[model samples]
Target: MSHPWFARPRPRVLAHRGLLPADADGIAENSFAAVAAAHAAGAAYVESDCHLTSDGEVVLFHDADLSRVTGDPRPVAEVPLVELERLMGARGGLITLRQALEAFPDLRFNLDVKAQAAAVPVGRIVARHAERVLLASFSDARRRTALDAAERFGRGIRPATSAGTATIGRTLSALAVRSMPLVRRALAGVDALQVPERQGRVRVVTPRLIEAAHACGVEVHVWTVNDAPHMTRLLDLGVDGIVTDRADVALRLVAERR
Candidate 1:
C-alpha cells in the first residue's frame, strides 16, 4: 500500500512556499499569509522550508540568512523569533511549523529541512501528525537524522519522505544503467522522488525513469513548475505530483481537466 502521504489526489498540487508568485505585491514565501493563500486557492498540500531561530524556535523561513527576504545581513539562527516576526510582520507574519499545522488542519505539508538545528525539532513536531507530513532535505544525512529523531519519538509511524540529492543522484545513475536492483536499493526508505523536470542540460523526467519508479511503487513529483504548458506536459508525462510557485493556477488547470 502507498503511504498515507500519497493517498491524496494524483497530480497533486504542492504549492511551493505557499503560492507567493514573483510578482506578488505583499505576501512573502514561507509566511502565514502564503500558506493561507495556498489553502484558500484549493491546494491540499503546501511545500515549505524550516529553519531555527537564535532562540531555538523552529520557524518557516527559507534562506539561511535574512538578507534577501528581510534585508538584515544576519543568519536566521542569529535572529530571535521575536525579531523575525517583526521583520515578516509587514510582509506576511512569521509562522512557526507548529502554528501552521494547527492553523491549517486540513492541509498536508511537504517540509524541507533547511537547517541542521531544525532536524530534530521538525521530526518531533511532525511525529504527532505523521499522516499528512512529508519530510525532506537536500542532504541525505540530515534527512535520515530527522527520520531517526522521529523514530525516537515513538510515533510508530514515520512521516513520508522524498529522496535527497544524494539518493536522487544514485537512483538516476542506476536507472541510466537499467539496473533495477540498484534503483530499488537507492529508493529503499523513500516514498517519493521529488525532482526538477530538467537539471541543466539533462532531462531528468523521462518515461523510462517514471516507469521504473512506478514499478517500485514510488511516485515521481516534479518541483518549482510554474507555467501551464509545462504543467500540462508533465501531467501528460505521467508524473504524480507538481510542486509549483503558481499553485492557484495549477489548481485551476488540474480542476479544469477533471
Candidate 2:
C-alpha cells in the first residue's frame, strides 16, 4: 500500500528549508517564519534538517553549527534549547519538531536527520505523525535507526523514508549494469530517492534513473533546484518532486505545467 505521504499528486514542490523572502529580512531558513511563508505560498511539503541541542531538544536547523546563521561559532549540540531559542528569537522563531508538527497540521514534512543523537528522538516524535512525515539522511545507519525507533515507539507505525547516500550509490551501480533485480533490491523499503540532479560532475537524475525508480515503485526527487528553467527541465524528465528554495516559483511552474 502507498504511504499517505504519497497520496498527494505528483510533481510535488518541497520547500527547501522553507521559503525565504526576497527582501533582506532577518528570517532564517528552517525557522518558524520560513515554514509559515512556505505554507502561505501553497507548498504542501517542507524540507528541513534536524539536530539535537545541548538540552536534547530536536530543532529544525541545517548546519551543524550556528556560525553561518547566527554568527555563533558553537555547535548546535553545545547550546541548550533555551539559549538556542533566545539566539534565534531575533532572527526568526526557533521551531521544534513537535511544535512544527503541531502548528502545521496540514503540511507534510521531509525531515533530514543530520545528527545521530536526534535519530531516536525524531523517530519517536514522527511516529505519531508518520502518515504526514518522510524521514531522510545521508547516513543509512542513522536513517534506519530513526525508522526502527519510530516502529519501536509508535507501535509498528513507521514513517515514509528516502534512500540514503550508500543506497543511492548501490542503486546507481546497479543501474550502470542494467540490473533490474539489483536496482529493486537497492530501493527496497524506501519510498523515494531524494538526490541532487548532479553530484559534482556526474548527473544523478537521468531519464534512465527515473524510469528505473518508477519501475521499482520509487519516486525521484531532485533537491535544491531554484531556477524555473531547470525546474521545467526536471519536470519534463518526469521527476516526482523538486526540492527548491523558491517554493513560490516552483508552485507557479507546476500549476502552469498542469
Candidate 3:
C-alpha cells in the first residue's frame, strides 16, 4: 500500500496550475516556465489540467476555450498543436503532457483530464510514468476511461488517482451512515480525494470526513486555497495535502510548521 505519491512529506503542497502571476517573461499559469518556478520554489507536487488539440495532441491547459487565457474564441479541440503553440508561444509556450513529464523528471504531477478526448492520451502518457502521476477529473467515467487506457498501455500499473465527483458523493454517503465496509468499498483504488472545502452553500471536508478518509488509508487534499491562515486551518484539520495557487507562501508555511 505504499504508493509512490505518498513517499514525500505529509501535508503536501501541490502547486495549482504551477503557481500564478509568474515572471513577466513567463506565462502565468500551466506554462513550462510556471512549472519551473514551482520547482524552484521547492514544491514537490504540481496540479494541472489537460486538453486535447484538434490534431490529437495533449496539452496542459485549463478551460474548454481559449478566451480566458488567450482572449481567442477558439476551443482547444479545434486548434492544431502547431497553431496552438504559435498562439501560446509568446505567453509562455504551449506545454504538452509528454513535454512536462520529460522536462520535470523529478516532479510529481496531478493532472485533471479536462476534455473527454484527452482522457486516453493522458493515460497513455501517464502510464509510462505511473509512479509520478496522479490522474483525476470531475467525471468518474472519464477518470476510469483514462485508467483503462493506462492499464492497456502502462504494462498493467495504474497511476495514482483522486476520486471524481460521483465517487466523492458515494464516499460521503457511506460516511454519513458510518459504514466502514461501504466507505472502504466506495474508496477502493483511489489514492486520494481532492475537493474544495465548500460547494455552493454546503461545506465539505469536515472532521468526520477527514477521519473517514484517513481510516481508509486515503488522503484528503483540498484545492484552490490561497491564504496562509486558511491553509493553516486546513492543515490543522488534518488534510494530507494543499493544492494552491500561492504555493510560495504555502511552502514557507510548511517549513514554519516543521
Best by TM-score: 2
Q: TM-scores of all models? A: 0.97, 0.98, 0.97
* CA-lDDT, candidates in order: 0.91, 0.95, 0.91
Residues 1-258 of candidate 1: C-alpha lDDT, one tens digit per residue = 677877877889999999775566877899898999899888999999999999988999899999999889999999999999999999988999999999999999999999988999999888888888999999988888888887788468888999999999999999989999999999998899999988999999999989999988889999889999999999999999999999989999999988
Model 2 stretches with alpha carbons more than 4 Å out = none
Q: Native-vs-model 1 lDDT?
A: 0.91
lDDT of 3 by residue, 205-233 (tens): 99998999998889999998999999999
Superposed Cα deviation of residue 87, candidate 3 (Å)? 1.2
Model 3's alpha-carbon lDDT is: 0.91
For TM-score, candidate 2 versus 3, the one ahead is 2
Name the weakest run of 10 consecutive residues (lDDT summed) in model 3.
Answer: 19-28
Top lDDT prediction, candidate number: 2
